[model samples]
Target: MRTAVGIDLGGTELRAALVAEDGRLLARRSTRTDAAGGPEAVLAQMTGLVADLDLAGARPVAVGVGAPGPLDAEAGVVTGPPTLAGWHGFPLRERLAAALGLSVAIDNDGHAAALGEWRFGAAIGRRHFVYVTVSTGIGGGVVCDGRLLRGRGGLAGHVGHMIVTDDDVVCSCGNRGCWEAVASGTAFGRQARRAAAADPAGRIAALAGTAPADARHVGTAAREGDPAALALVAEEARRLGAGIVGLIHLYSPEVVVIGGGLSALFDLFAPVIADAVATRAMPAFRDVAVVPAALGPDAGLVGAAALVLAPN
Candidate 1:
């Protein structure tokens, strides 16, 4: 069976896999990203991980890597990515090809993720949809007419930068009051910490040893009927919904897929987000079905591999 290698490069770690054309995982490997050493080191680490997977006889055709951005997809370079500190203007595709000695493709993580779903996951039958994942940060990919929309310089569905909350939360993009700043995992941790510090009696506050009472912890507490924790989650769900509603109005996707670590509590937040959208979004936009991301962290890996195998 002919195969391809896919790599998902994030700020914290790098993952790669050998995959079948039909979306089966043949092999996989992972390594920590060298963000501290800058882009050169990060790229080198990615190269090493792919090598370790060793797709010897599978007829590896191409490589696809999904990275955090602002990226110049046309140029195969990452431009001033805020999530990856000190790695500015990284020539991703060039570096990987030189190191691995293989033809390579690169894309913003969101765009890569969208492609993964359309090709291998839930969006396979859907022609128009958006895959939005809220992880350490927020990101999304737009698919219209069965093509992933790579808006100028790979910054199209940067809905995380949308200013939904009035709070002055600073975004890595050097902006205040951005949606990511208020609605992502980073935001959840930040808010949970503040709430914990202020309310010593609250579940999040009383629960020591947990890191910053993040979205996960808060969600857990709310599930157990903790009022203070419920409040935190409710606020986050509201902001998340507001941002999503904006995407709905703009893209009119047939479905909106929400993934990422934060999505562990999709059951807790989904209804709240849907309610917010119902009340806030225009009636026409309100019909867009909101759903959980079909692919997990594996979505990026599967998607990246798919890119190499299919190469549109």
Candidate 2:
């Protein structure tokens, strides 16, 4: 079977995989991203990972990378994604190609995830769909009429930056009231921390341990039936639902697939999200399915591989 090298580059982690054309992951490795060490260090880490995979003898046809963006996909350059410091205008494609001696493709992580799902996961056979990842931050990708919708500057699916509130929560994008600012895992953690500080008796304080409160703690607390944590999760669901409504209005996708680390809480949030979308969306859009991504954390890596196996 023909194979390809796939890399999912995130702010904190780097995942590399050898993926067959049939969407099977043959071998994979993951490690911490040397993001604080700057772009050169990140490149070295990626190169090493790819080299390890290459030694498996698959002889990949090309290398595909799914990375945090604000990127120039056409030029194969990263254009200052907030999560990845020191990567502005970095020639990621060129560097990878030079290091691996193979053709390379790059895209926004969200877009890659969407493509991955469309090709291999939840959105399979769906002509129009959206993939949203609600992790430390939120990001999204849209597929319209069976093609990935990469806007004029390859920045089309930045749904997280869509303003959702009038509150003063600032986003890493330097904006206030973005959906990410108020509803992402980071936002949920921030709210949990404040709640814990305000009410020392709350479950969040106990669950937080030595580290600061985060979305995981909130989810754990909710699962354990902590009222405060349950409330927080509900609020996040509402916010996320509101955003899904907006996406439905804009793209009219047949389904909206939610992924990322926070998606583990989908069972807790899906009902509220479904209700919000059902009630608030236009009558015509009320039936749109809101579902968890089937590919899980592998979506980006598989989607990155699709860049080489299926370019659309």
Candidate 3:
């Protein structure tokens, strides 16, 4: 089977994989990102990981990368994603291509994930859809009329940054009331931590103990039928659903696929999201399906590979 190299470069971790033509991940390796070590260190780490995947014996024809955004996909340059400090204006595609001695393609992680789903996952056969990853912060990709919607500078599908509410919480993008600011996994954790501090005897507090709490603690408490945890999750789902409703109104997509770290709790969030859309979305767009991503955590990796395996 023909194969390619795919990389998912994130703020905390760097993952590399060998993906077959059919989207199966044949081999994979990952390491914690050396953000403190700067771009050169990260590049060396990434190259070493790719070399290790090469030993798996599938001569990859090309390489594809899904990197954090504010990037110029057309120019193959990374223009300073907040999470990836020191990557401003770096020619990622060209550097990787030269190092690997092969063709290389790169795009925003959200766009890559969307392409993966469109080509090999849940959004298959759908001409209109949106893929949203709700993790540390929200990120998204859109497929319109069977094509990835890459707006000017490849910044089109930044649905997370969309102003979804009236709130004081500032998003990493230095904005107030962004969907990500209110509904992302980071936001959920922050809220949980505050709630736990206020209610020392509550179930959420008991689950979190003294350590920093995140969305996972909330999920655990919710599963145990804790009322506060359940309420927090419900509110998060509502916020996420509210943003998704906007996407439906704007893009008229057939389905909205949810992925990322929080997707592990998709079963918990799905019903609430459905209700938000049903009640708030315009009557004409309420029929859109909101579902979990089919590829789960592998979506980014497979989607990155799709960049090289199947170009726009």
Candidate 4:
């Protein structure tokens, strides 16, 4: 029962967990990420967290980190992560290794989550698969041949930045008409708010207690049977399913697991995404089963800790 530490870094806080080789979460905790002080300060706090966990005598092989993307995993450097300001060109893996005196591996957060799910979650017993999480942005990861398929530089799963439609919306990635701009949780929520504002009958307005402005509100309204909210959700499902179609064409996975707060409405969206995939994806790709992520909110930490147990 060896253990390793897995860190999930984000714009607001950093979550670390001690995970056993078999996917049990032995210990888990979190700390706020100070955006003003930048990556160095965050790194310091992260190291302190690992120290607090008392891993000084642990036998885990390595530390696995799930970080915001656009990173240079091989070089251990963060080229530029837009969500976290001043993280440009930061030596993430090297800095953590030096701070913890342990080998460190860094990955795009989505890829890490996908790896986590594959190793120990619903993705178990599956071969080719795709993972999509819609939070601050729509993040994705690919698993092929029972291994994570991060592309060169590990930015391969930047599905949010993919241009699915030629709509006029702009993505944070600075690309016009990117999928994130149109169908991400951010976008889903934004659209719901707009509709609610224009039409007081929209359910998201009441659910948010005042015309909410994030996908969570929309999903809640959809669950409650709001017409406007349901339409928005339908759009989200189609958009998300379209993305799944692309992955199916590329990897031909046995299953597609989707998670994140927004995915709570999987019952409402799965059919739409499934319908879209069937309509658009090739026949061979059509048979893939699309399902909800087995692990809930803590998938990243669970999967990350498992990274330490990977045999060399």
Candidate 5:
């Protein structure tokens, strides 16, 4: 079977994989992004990762990358994504093409993940849906009428930056009241840490066990029925659901697939998120399926490959 090279470049790690068209991961390699080293350093590391993957004698036809955005997908340029500092105006697609001697494609990581789920995971066969990744930051992609919505600048899927509240929380994107500033894993961890500080004897602190509290600890404590953690989770779900409600109003999607780090605990959050949607969404949109993303952590990688395998 023919294969493609997919790279998932994040603020913390750079991962590349050899993947079959059928969504099978043939081989993979990864390393820390060391983002502070600048674009050239990270580019070299990404190239090395692809070279390290076991290709099994099958030459990849193309390379696709899912990177943090504020990018120009059509132009294949990285245009000052908040997470990838120093990558402003970098011609990522052009550079990768030169480095790999293959055609290159690139898109926002969120958009890539949505494409992955659409083709091979949860949203398969669905013509309309939204995919949200609630990780260190919130990011999303919208599939409308069988097409991923890539606006003029390929910036249509930036649901995270949607201003969902009037609070003073400043997002990494330099905006106030962004959904990401309040509902992302980073927000959850910050809330957990604050709760832990106030109540050093609380379940969240205990779960942290001398380490810093994060979203995982909150999930664990909530699962254990700790009141503070439970409250935190409830607030998180409500804020997340509010964002989804906005999406429903805008897209009226058939489903909303939740993914990313916090999604590991979707079993616990789904119910609350669904309830929030049920109460807040219009009656016409209440029946939309709110489900966990099936692709897990590989969604972005597979979606990146899908960009090469299936352009749309």
Candidate 6:
């Protein structure tokens, strides 16, 4: 079976894996992204990682990278993604290709995750689906007619920036009322902290532990039956659901897969999300299944592999 090298580059860490054509991970390695050192340092770390992924005798056909975007995928350049400072216009694909002596393909992490699910996880055999990751921020990827829907500039599927409210919260993209600004993990964290500060005697504050309050603390408090935390989580779910409803109205996908760090709390929020979609989506779109991603944390890595093994 043919194999390929898959690299998932995030704001804080980088993961590389050798994956077979059938989607099995063969070997893997990970390291912190030296993002503070700038793009050159990050590139060096990526190259070194690829060199270290003992592929044995199975030579990789190509390298596939799933990186945070606002990138020019066609040109293989990073275009000022807020997560990666000093990466504006950096020729990541060309640099990786030169260092690894292999052709490289790159796309936004959200697209890669969607592709990965389409190829080997929840959306398999489905011709139309959407994948949304809600973490520090929200991002999305869409597959229609069995093909990834990268727009003319490979900038499609950025569902996070879609306006969902008239609130004053500003997004990292500098937009107010973006879906991400109101519904992402960052938003949850901010809200949780505010709630904690407002009610110093509440369980929400104690649930936060020594760390700053975040979505996870909200989940913990909710799980422990804190009504205030439950209400906050419910609100987050509703906001997220509103975005998914918009996506459903636009794409009419067969399935919507949710992933990312915040998805760990899916159980607490899934019902609210499902209810919102069922009640708010158009009749024809109501049947769309909203599901959790099956590949878990490996979705990006596998999706990166799919970029080379099953280019779309």
TM-score, per-candidate, Cα-based: 0.94, 0.97, 0.97, 0.93, 0.98, 0.98
Alpha-carbon local distance difference test for all models: 0.82, 0.91, 0.90, 0.80, 0.91, 0.91
Best first by TM-score, ranked: 5, 6, 3, 2, 1, 4
Model 5 lDDT tens row, 1-312: 878999999999889999899888999998889899999999899888988889989899899899998789999999888888899999999998999889999999999999999988999989999999999999989999989999988989899999998999999889999999999999988999999999999999998989999988998898889999999988888888899999999998999999999998788778888997888999999999899899899999999999898757
- lDDT for model 5: 0.91
- True-structure lDDT of candidate 6: 0.91
Clash totals, every prediction: 0, 0, 0, 2, 0, 0
Instruction: Report the lDDT tens digits of candidate 1 across residue range 149-224.
Output: 8878767888788787677778877799988888888888888888888887778776744555677668778898
lDDT of 5 at 17: 94
Q: Against the true structure, what is every candidate's RMSD?
A: 1.7, 1.2, 1.1, 1.9, 0.9, 1.0
Report the C-alpha lDDT of model 2 over 16-119, residue by residue, as the tens digit. Answer: 99999889999998899998999999899999998777436677899999999889888999999888888888999999899889999999999888888988
Candidate 2 versus truth, CA RMSD in Å, comes to 1.2
Q: Worst lDDT window (10 residues) for model 4?
A: 303-312
As for lDDT, the candidate ahead, 1 or 4, is 1
lDDT of 5 at 52: 87
lDDT tens readout by residue for model 4, 140-249: 78878877776787678787787888788889898888878887777777787787788765566666675355677777777777778788888888888887888788
Residue-wise C-alpha lDDT for candidate 6, range 188-285, written one tens digit per residue: 88999999999888888887767778888889889988999999999989998999999998888999999999999989989999998889998888
The clash tally of candidate 1 reads 0
